[model samples]
Target: MGRAPNTPYAASRYSAGGDGPVQQTAFIGQAATRRRLLGGALMAGGALAVPGLVRGQVLGTPSLVPMRLSPDQLVDMKCCLRPLRAAGPNLGTESVGGKLVVHNYGHGGSGWSLSWGSAEVAVGKALASLPRSVAVVGCGIIGLTSAVVAQRYGLDVTIYARDQIARTRSFRASGSYTPGSRIALVEPAGPQFPDLWEQMARHSWRMFRTMLGLPGEPVRFGDSYAVSDAPIERRTWPADPAITESFATAGLPRQNSEFAHLDSRIADIVPQAVPLPPGENPFGMPYATRSSQMHFNFPAYAAILLDEFFGRGGKFVNRVFHRPGELADLPEDVVIHATGYAARDFWGDRTVIPVRGQTGWLVPQPGVNYSLRYRNVSALSKGDGIVIMNNNPDLGDMLGVGDSMELPNRAPIEEAMATLAAIFARSAGAAA
Candidate 1:
């Protein structure tokens, strides 16, 4: 049916059509022809899509931009807590200061990923109130997006924030497409949350797709590899009971009671996870998977969102609200509350708590264009910098569950870089 490994116009094994002597000579000739074809393909920046070829055996030409990372290469670090809400991002409304306040904060770690979808929900509720204008609190992803969405809805939008997008907590994110990362306590958010989360995630995915080829390549998707010494078993959400216990967080929606199972819900939409054949494994690890994911280059993306907001006649007011009464001072009667972690003190929402996340960056390396995760350490090559973050908490027992230390943790950064150094060493050895 198909061409044989070393034969042209090859006959099927079951076929007895070819004369044995003629077929033997043709096979040898085809081998040399194939080699010539391969050489030509490599010269043209292409690889033969030959079926059944193992991955490692035929390495592609060296990467155009060579990169080797070391522990001492670390240049900067950013840290922030995901403002987790027990009931998920508060997209509904609450009455405050004689105005309809649309709660759009507490998206946890999914702020950048879920901004568009959640903004849509928040604006829908605001428009329903038939307000002439809207006041958006905060200038992070949620606030910026909320302003843009409001402008599109024909509402005069004004953003009030303590810091602009570049300095906001949202900028501290790793900028991955994790729409449901600790978004809420499963039990408190209720069975209905899956539908809401799915709706937001799907909508956000559509919006992000439209920005693929824009200037700065603000939103991007690229290949990523996950490697491990042990089999990378497929895990369903609410991970094994014991493992879930390790993720146990403290707070209103206690980890014991609110373990979220949202990851599996949107698995069908995100890049499909597939096991890599031994030949395809890049890390030379026993187990590995290759996939692609959407990553936000926050600096570029933030600039785009901010520019769009300003171009649409949106106003930015550097105002901070410390309490609910501050809402009365705003010129508009409709408000979108996207203050994120600040909601704990400003709006008196005790349900909001922080889950600390930290990331370190090596100076920008424009050539490296891939991401890798192994042994709980992850790295992404971004235009702003080469991001390296340890997903596992530095504290021995916390596992980063409910822990919310906002300050930078140097130990984890050191450990993460050490792991990457080892990975690069192994990779160099394999190449040698």
Candidate 2:
């Protein structure tokens, strides 16, 4: 076969040099030399240091993670969140007020982190009751993930959704590694929920780690989330026992974010986090902080995972249920509720607000590896791709610290041009 069309994604010649003339290719006159030192960008399994790059590649495999590796799996997307279209008429089996109800919804962001842990808790109730048939509502990240977990527990799960699995908010998301406001104190809190939140975070983080071991999918790289000024205190908790116990083991300091604007329940988990020196910050926000994160390509990862679920004896039903009575017809004993933003209407959960985020990605700028986000708006370069992280809107959230609901009408090409132009303008301005 002739070589495939390069399209516009062909690597830019100027990406290698800071602000130099463009070369005809990704490699340069000195590229042969640099190639020996910097062959590629970093992935989960293999990595090497080319002296200048901290998280990029080296000449050979340096202590590979012993898992399959495929850098080609990385794919850039240009899409928008197809928000739920309608007033869902409660196709719930259990009662909201009193009908064997177990409601798990309203994860504005951080749905991935809270997915497995939340499903674990939701399924625990159904398992205790010994239901033979279970019904799962919504096929967003929460629903699909919950169904997978329920199936793992040997429950026959029927996933019901109005839209196709890959067309929801889950797909539209620029899946960053940070956990946005999935859990909060909007509900009256006791010590109980705080413990559960901590437990859920740990479990979700571990699940993500396991996923990183897989090959040819979106899950890799250590990121440093630069959080600016924000309030980290005054959140409520839940009422769960096992969750509480597992949380105490976290060894996190209480009043940690209280005395300061920073908290550290996960500082021990991520290996790379330290205060940046005065000149280390990229955008120069008021305060610069760094915490390792995982920027993801949601479509690739979800496609692989969903295929695995369906292939492994899992069942999914595509129907937009209007009443809770419709769920009773499924062939299972236990049910898990994993609907995310859809819960806004399905369960009358108004908390599932849609916070829109706009990101501009140019053709791969491989050398800019470090993810730099001080506000919700950020600029970072992937090996051969790029994305701007989104946020779940909340009070006290810093500038560019929250995703918008503006529909992200910007196209990738437009975004890429704008970003590159901005960089070019800044450089030109500095020279003058």
Candidate 3:
């Protein structure tokens, strides 16, 4: 009982009585091994009855696999991990000089999507500061862009973050087309936030438009298409409570609406924003509208933005600021909090939930000019001509979102590949 279990072997063999079935089993195994060596098919004991696809050095693997987005499009969560909660107190309160503390963080998955618009809102308040020095917390898109706007105003600005510029989540983003109204306006009041919405969007658009042809930087102009599966009667944002509470911008034509609802606002701004002909929409999209999402090549864009900031005599300090009282140490008069989701802990403001949105990208579709989407599903072939996304709307916030939202549901990437594979599959005449 204390020894190894032996089935095909006899006790007599071990007792030195005679040769036994154990030898026969070993002999059979040897024979099978020899046969496998010669036949190029190997058997593992009695477990397997047939060879598997991976068992041999096969030829010609299919270019794509189902539910797998552009294999070329990969995201590493390690580069984009934000602590689920702040370990200490919110560090962005108190007056930097004589100005008020304007908090602007908690943008979860929509950082890239709403960067320009959100930054405009934050910067609008910052500009009102009239402080000679402005301090921006966190080093992601919002902070960087806010700092840029501050610089444009000729204010001496400083950036503080636990990490550096390119190493932040903004760099790892799958930045695609902008669905602007993604931000949740937390106002207990009624339809009074539209004016600020209009102001923010228009400014961000103008700001982004101004950067259209720079020599490869953060702000870019690239054609983006929104192909839909159905007619978009996008729900309108009745009103933004925050806009009302913050800016008193009520009833000025700003609403939380879908893309089709506000196509006119961005028509002239986006290069290819136009209605798609009925024949081009396969997902049964009742109407199609195209726009060039403010293309942000994180690598080049974020680098250039930060580079320009630093080059322009901006000061950046590398320190983990966990409490607002800690800001007193820095010699600045104003602080613009661009801490992103970390504001949850820093400010103790739970109003900001990590609205887990995701985007999937393809390798690059050079000549592909149109952005297409059916339902929330979308596609782009530039620098990877596909982008798919899944947000917390269905699944709720991503606690450990890190960067790769493509993990459990494989949301964005799967949709991207299936879409491309489907289109090409049709072009190649493959069955759905």
Candidate 4:
């Protein structure tokens, strides 16, 4: 018989008849050789199916950006209340002590994300009065953006606030483009609100694009990974009795109250999330997904907005308004009331609910540029610092609903650091 070609898949040929130890030894050797070839072929096929595994080993896990996760790394902690209104942001004009007050506050957690768009609405209304000048009530992101928008229309703008941008609650936010984050209760906001939300989201998205390549990367995109041990499924609102009762007791939105999710409306403009294959998931978790998110670097972003406002002949007045009537005392007949959560008490608007949010800042790690979420905790490595926050998917927006505590809590951040530490440790062990 002729010998077969020396290929992994080729069949081996043996003599038609064989006897004694010499023939048996030859047969055994051929069987062993065939087994080796078959095993090699299976391994080669596996390598082709999962190139990421081979590349991961060679490239040292490109997806797993190293982070120094520890409580000791926490340099600062900030707590702020997101002003959530049941009927969405107050964008309508109202007569306040004879002054045409255009309400632009109560954006909840979507203030930064919807600032420019909301500003367009507020400023447009303010301009209709044919006022030569305008006054913004707050110095937060919404107020700052609105003032800048007013300036673009050639309206001399003056910001009257007790606190500047740095001291305002907006400065403490986990600055990200979360356009629909607890913006409003679906039923209370009505059908028209979503359209308004889309308008604002699209406008703000376009405005953010303009600031992308600016100095200090005030607005930039980064990859975010959501890692989990369980298989990723469609997230649903929690129906747990305890959670519902707590929300009810706190006078917050119930579990059944759906929050407006308007992100899908602008999906074309925003980046979509994609599931990560097993071989590509570097988080050491069973399931993972990645998406790009826009982040606002507070110091740089605030500075640029402030610079543009002042460069356009705008002014800031260090004044505190104890009542809505005080707005009429301002020189400008048209005013934009962008007091954010403060509008709840100052404007006597009970619809504005306070949702407490806290973030811990860590020393900046230039090498780590990605963001991650694992075990109810989220971490984003920004140019200024690494921001870590407690964001449980199960709780949804209800995580901080009805909590007005502005004092920073160190315990939650410490717990989040520990969770991150375990994640990184397991990843390191897997790599080793």
Candidate 5:
């Protein structure tokens, strides 16, 4: 992976040798050397440090909650392929055998995060046809949201998909608001994409904010911490042309630099991460940052969305389309093509790249409400379950890019659990 370009809040700004305050604890004897050795060992092993050795508890700082991260606690695992396109998502209108088809798929990992806003775009195009009814080809988040938005426009809508929302790839998402995650490659997407992306992201953010306090807590905000033994590096966009050009032959998805970091365009609307001083850092890692993250509890959120759709007279047809010609058979003249990764085959779109992602779920904990990222492992405690994912930056954006295997692998999940176990074990040692 290439070196990431720095930003204002990059590691240099908050590192120990940077502008941040330095630790002033006195080291008077050999005991201090032993403590340093122990800290080095824990850091090398990807473990947290003892609280007493770091600093006394900081006021208002919450203690880290332990999670049952063993393989035995794993209830289920799911894998899905994110539809990635080098030029970003296909959000244009086209004529399909005399039928007006609006494209709304290929958002990559940002499907869930950008659904509402993208739906607004696709539905607006569909409305221009002045059709009495419309059909959505898939029941994933994108398709479902498009149907709901169409219903809001007083257009009779029906979804035609082989499976419902629960079985679709969107259900396996990490559920965080990550609008810029694997969205598009920098050179291919061109200059105009950032402004269009900002429009979608800001609209989606506002729509999500409307669901914050709804019944069943479909959407809510929680603190998420990114902790590390070394300074945290934040990647910026407009990577080197040589590096961006290598992505085509590398046979892997574009790395962080190659992807457009459109989230920064809406930075003012989104919560900014703040560096955690030693006292406020609960993970005991040498460096850490915290930011408010919005999460979607899919199980509850899906139910609310489906109920609202059904109540508004929206219908669903359990059908599969083998090719674009099959879409012409539908009763509606206007169709929102939201088949997601299936578009790679059905629509003969070779640009739809498959980026595989998997998540392991553990039974929900009672009071574990926050999220954490240590090393390459991430744990999110949502209302449905605890989502454990391997987001290794060492692999860059190519972590699971170009892979289409949907089978769940336990080895990765078990390895991630071991990492979490080590962190919690050291946390317990500190509490003792």
Candidate 6:
């Protein structure tokens, strides 16, 4: 890994030392030490420190909810390949089969995160042609959102899909607010996409805010604890010349190939991430950070979308298109393609790659409201279930970087549960 880029936050003493030529890890450790001393000083003086300081510690046996993730408790298993594209999402227009088609697919894992905003863009293009009736293809998050937005735009929108939300790949999503997760290959999307990505994320976030506190608890926010037993490594991500060159043929420069940090750009909008003090770490892990995160309970959330769509006079046609020519049979002059991975064969899109993800679900624990990702395994405790996904093999160094398995592998699920059980076992030992 290269030296971290000299961003203002990265240059802070807590990140990289303010002094010249400091090793990033050593400087961060020093900052952590300083925070520990400060916390101790406040405790010795009998002075009531900040509200978050005492409550956030997890080093000791804090009132942390134990996650019951034993193999016997596992209830379900599901997997889906994220429709990843190198150039972000394909929000473009084309005249196909005498129809004004607005391509709005290829959102990757961020389809749910960017649905509203991407639909806004696609529908804007559709509206430019002054079409009275619009056809939305697919029924995943992107398709459902596009249909709803089109209806809101005063168009008679009809959704054509082979499968409903329950059967679609979107149902398998982890339902986190991860806008950049496999959104685009870092190089091919170029520099301009970061701005557009932010716009979409911000718009969808506003909509998500409105959905919060609604019936069924479809949209909600919760706390998460990130615990790591190993030393935190910081990498100065250098611009890849190969990626730059690849995008150059597509009219993009190397400097413009990297995706900008959305966290830095929208710090005010998202919840603030706070590091836990030494004694406050409850997970018995060496490093820990706790923060609030937005989550979409997908099962309930998808049902609400369908309910609202039907309530608003939107229509759904149970149909599937085998190829682009089949789309012409539909009775709409305008078509919005929100067909996730199916676009590969339906529209002959070679860039639509299938990146397989294997996941397991445990019986829901109402008390375990928080989520955690440790050692390449992630667990989210939604109302439906405790969704667990293994990113890599047990004790593996790296997660699935370019994995493309489209089929389910039961072995990963078994490995994930075993690893999760071990983590809880270790925590039990520490607590006892």
**Best model per lDDT:** 4
Pairs clashing within candidate 4: none
Q: What lDDT tens digits, residue by residue, belong to model 6 across residues 1-432?
A: 554443222211111113211223223334455467547846774212322112212113234456666678777777787777778899999987899899999887788889889999999999998999999999999999998888888889889999988899898877878786667766577779888988998999999999999877788887777767875443344555565344335432223224333445667788866777765665655777777888888878888888878888889999978888888788899999989988978889978766667678888776566787676677888777888887743313113424566567777777877776676666545544
Between candidates 1 and 4, which one is better according to lDDT? 4
What are the per-residue Cα lDDT tens digits for candidate 2 across 309-399? 6876777778876655555665544456556655556656543334344454444543344555433345454433566434322333221
Query: What lDDT tens digits, residue by residue, belong to model 4 across residues 153-259?
Result: 99999999999899999999988999988898887789899999999999999999999979899999988888888877657664566654433255568774467
Which RMSD values do the candidates have, in order? 9.7, 12.0, 18.7, 13.0, 11.6, 12.4
lDDT of 2 at 230: 53
Is 2 or 3 the stronger prediction by TM-score? 2
lDDT of 3 by residue, 276-327 (tens): 5643322222455555555655666676777879887888888797776677
lDDT of each: 0.74, 0.48, 0.49, 0.81, 0.81, 0.72
lDDT of 1 by residue, 1-432 (tens): 666665554311111122211111223347667678667755664434221211322222222122335666678788898888878888878888798888999998799889999999999999997988999988989989999999988888899899999998888888889886778776678889899999999999999999887888888886777778888876443423553332235454433335465767778879976888864565545677878888888888988888888898888899877788879888899999888988888888878877788898887665566787887888887767778888742331124555677788778877877886676556545544
Backbone clashes in model 1: 2
**Candidate 5 error regions (>4 Å):** 1-60, 235-254
Clashes of 2: 28
Cand. 2 TM to true fold: 0.62
- Cα error, residue 345 of model 6, in Å, equals 1.0
lDDT score for residue 191 of model 2 = 41
Look at candidate 6 and tell me the lDDT of residue 224.
Answer: 77
Return the lDDT, model 2, position 341. Answer: 56
